[model samples]
Target: MARSLRYFSPRRECPFITIDLGSIPESLFESELFGYEKGAFTDARKAKAGRMEVASGGTLFWMK
Candidate 1:
């Protein structure tokens, strides 16, 4: 169903991001979902776009 939605989405040029909530630890879920600036964390040497950011104007699917 997710694949089908992506296939026919109007925002086909945008991305389709999927995150497995079951695999990620609770402590890190926020950053992973919403992203963070550089130096936001001990290991965040550079800014990185999170799943939601990457899927901007597109589809964001979270699976447990």
Candidate 2:
């Protein structure tokens, strides 16, 4: 199921991002999805964009 989705190409000019929900830890979900601003945490040294931000004007696919 995931293989086909991974290979599916959209007829658009946006990027595609996929997330394997089963492989990700529950604790990291929030930060992974919404991201955080630089200096928002002790370990955050540089500004970073989350999945949602990266997926802007693109496609975000999730497989369980």
Candidate 3:
């Protein structure tokens, strides 16, 4: 909920990029931000990309 205020704020650096905070699940913390391959851990059943890859072409702002 703390991250929501960033969306409503009008003043920001012109060249900065912002990613939304809503719809983030707590369980996704490990798999989403840091890329981990399949079998890297016990519960990882399949290979998948992380947010760093998704945000590779752009700047990603993580609020707090």
TM-score of each: 0.88, 0.73, 0.48
Q: After superposition, how far is residue 20 of candidate 3 from its true place, in Å?
A: 8.7
Clashes of each: 0, 0, 0
- Which candidate has the top score in lDDT? 1
Please report, in order, the local distance difference test score of every candidate based on alpha carbons.
0.89, 0.77, 0.61
RMSD (CA, Å), candidate 3 to true, equals: 7.0
lDDT of 1 at 32: 93
Please write out the lDDT profile of model 3 over residues 2-44, one tens digit for every residue. 2355445553222234444555677777677776899988888
Model 2, 1-64: lDDT tens per residue?
6446545656245667788898889987888888888898889898778888888877788888
RMSD of each: 1.1, 2.9, 7.0
Task: Give per-residue CA lDDT, model 1, range 6-31, as digits (tens).
Answer: 78878777888889999999999999
Off by over 4 Å in 2: 1-11
TM-score order of candidates, top first: 1, 2, 3
